[model samples]
Target: MTDRTYIDIHVLHSVPPSNLNRDDAGSPKQAVYGGVRRARVSSQAWKRATRVAFTDELHLPAEQLGTRTKRISSLLARRIAARTGLDDVAAARLGTALLAQDLNIKAGKKETETAYLLFFGINQLDAIIDLIAERAEELAALADDALTKAVADLPVREQLTSGHPIDVALFGRMVADITSLNVDAATQVAHAISTHPVEIEFDYYTAVDDQKTAEEDAGAAMIGTVEFTSATLYRFATLGVHQLTANLGGDTNAALDATRAFLTAFVRSMPTGHQNTFAHRTLPSLVSFVVRDDQPVNLVSAFEKPVRSRNSGIAEESARRLAKELSRAASSWGVTPLAVASVYEPNSDQNTDTLAAFGVPHSLDEAIASVLQAVRGRLQEPA
Candidate 1:
C-alpha cells in the first residue's frame, strides 16, 4: 500500500480584538464554526485584497472570475454601440446575442459567460476609442460643450453594429463569474488566502495599469484623462511531489527538485513592491516539507499543529517538543519504513489558542531549527 500523509500550511494573521455581530460592518472577533470558534477575517477588508492579489497571480481575466458578467457586458456593449450609432435595444441584443453564441464557447465552458462579457467590454472600449477619433472632426465643428455631452452619450448608442463588441460581451461575463462581483451585490472576498494554478503570459497592458493604479490619481476630476485600466498578468504555479513526478516521466525525486527549483525561482524574482499588504500582512508563515518511504501505515502522529504557540521563543520550543514527540511516535510503532514530514506556522496568539483547543500544549520556543532536524531524524530512522 502507498503511504500518504496530509499537511496543512497555516497562515497566521495578527488581528486585533473586536466586538461585532454577524451583520455588523466589522468581522467577528470570535465566531464558532463546526463547534469551535474560528479566528475571523473580514471578507471586505484585507482578505479581499489578498484574494485579488492571488487572482492577479492566477492571470485569469476579471471576466472569467467575477460574477458581474451581465452588467459589465451590458455596460460594454452600450459603450460600443453608442459610438457606432446604434440604439439601446440593439446594443443589448448585440451583447446578449454574442453571449449566447460562440463568443463564450471558445474560451472553455468553465466560465464562458463571464469571459464573453469581458471580451465584449474590452472590444467595446476599443470601438469607443475608434468612434471618438472618427467623429472628432464632426463633433469639433459643433460647440465645445455640445461635443462633451455628445461623447458622454455616444457609448449608449454604439452597442449594436453586429461584429464589433462580441468579445467584450463574452469576456466581461467571465470576469463577473470568477470575481463574484455583480450589480446587485457589492464585491467582497471570501478568505485571506486562496491558491490556484494557471497558465499565463506577459501582458504589457496589465503591468502598466498595475503601476499606474498604485499611484494617486491626480486627474480624478479632470475630463478625458487617464483612468483605471485592468492589467494583464502572468502566472507561475507551484506543484507537489506527485504532480512533479507525473510531469517529469514518473521520477518522484526529480519532480520534487523541479518543484523546488520552480518555487525558488518564482519567489526570488517576485517584485518587492508586490509584497506590500494593506493590514500589516506578514510573509508566508509556514513551510511544508514532505517525506515519503516504504513504511507501514497507521503510525501517523495524532497531533497536527506544527508550530508551537506560547511566548516569544515559540519556534525553538515547538521544534524541540515536536522532536521529542516524534521520537515517541516512532518508538511506539514496531516498524518504521521511511517518511518525515515537517509543517511550520508562525507563532501567533490565534494559532496558539487553536493548538490549545486541540489539547496540544505548544510554546513559541519549540520552533528552533535544531528541533526540526532532530524530529526529522527520528521520523526518518529505519527499522
Candidate 2:
C-alpha cells in the first residue's frame, strides 16, 4: 500500500440563534441525513470564512495569496498600469493580449473576461508583469510579433507554483477552458451538520420610523421574518500532507507552517451570515487532531443515530458521543496515528479518558504547538 500522510481534524462547536449559512431564499441551509432534517453549513461557506481568517487574523503576506474573481482582465490591467506607468487603455490592451495568449478567452468581446471564475495567485500576476517589463521596449515599439513571442515564452505554471499561496494550494483552482491551469485541492472539507435533528425557527421583526411620531405613523415602517436555528455542529476536514508538500514545490518547512496556520484559523473562523441580526461568534468546545499514514477517518458516523441532550448541553453530549465513536472506530480499524492531540472543556460526567486514552490532552494553544512539533519532527526524519 502507498504510504500517504493525512491530517484529520474534528470540532464540536455550538452556535447560538443564528443563520451561519443560508440558501437563495435567505433561509438556513438544511439537509436530510439519517432520515431527519439537520442544520447544515456548506463547505464553500466555511472555506471562504477560513480563507478570510488567513488574511484578517493570521496576517499572511499578500504575496502568498490568491484571488478568486471573474474580473481577471481588470485586475491584471490595474497591476500592469501600476508597474509599467502606462495609461489605463494601453495597460488594458496589454492585459487582454497577455491573458488571451495564456487563457482560453472568448472571441470578439469588447471587455476581456474569462469564461468562468479564475483563481490566480499574486506570484503569477507579478511574473506576468515582470515578463512585460523585460520587453517594455519591444512592447512600446508597437511590434505585435515581438510582443507575442515574448508572451509565448512566459511560464504560467512555474510562476503559479513558485510562491504559491497556502489557501490556493489547499483549496485549489480551476480554469475550465484551459484544463492545464486546473489545480486539485489538497484539503477536503465536509459540510458541518448538527449532531441532532433540527427544525428551522423564524423570528418576526419590525422597524419603526424614527422621524414620524406615533400619532403620524401608527404602523411599523417595515417588517420581515428571518429563518434561523441553534445547534451544536460537528465539523470535519482532512489535509493531505503529501499533496500539500507537493503543491508547495516540496518545501517541507513551508508545508508545516501552512498546516499550523490552517489549524489555528479553522478553529477560530466563523461564517458571517446575517451577523448583524444574530451575532453568533463562538470557538469550538472541543478540537481534535490526528496525523496518520492510513486513510483519513471521519467520526461523523457516530452521530448517525443522533445524540439527545439530557442533563448536559448538546455540545457536551455531542463531545461524549464523538469520543466514544472515535475509540471504537480506531480499535476496529486497527489504526494508530503517528500523533494525536485534543483540547476540550471540562465535564464531570463525560469520559475524558476516551480521548486522553489515545493521546495527550492539552489546552488549545498547547494542542496547536504540540501538533506542529509532531508534524515537523516527522518531516525531519529521512524516508
Across 168-255, the per-residue lDDT of candidate 1 in tens digits comes to 1111122343333111111111332111111112212212233446456643332331111111111112122332233233443433
Please, what are the lDDT tens digits per residue for candidate 2 over residues 257-320?
8888889888899999999989999888989998877888888998898878877878877877
Best by the lDDT measure: 2
Deviation from truth (RMSD, Å), model 2 = 2.4
Query: When superposed on Cα atoms, how far off is each prediction in RMSD?
Result: 18.5, 2.4
Q: Please give the CA lDDT of all the candidate structures.
A: 0.32, 0.81
The parts of candidate 2 lying over 4 Å away from their true place are 1-3, 107-112, 143-146, 349-351, 380-383
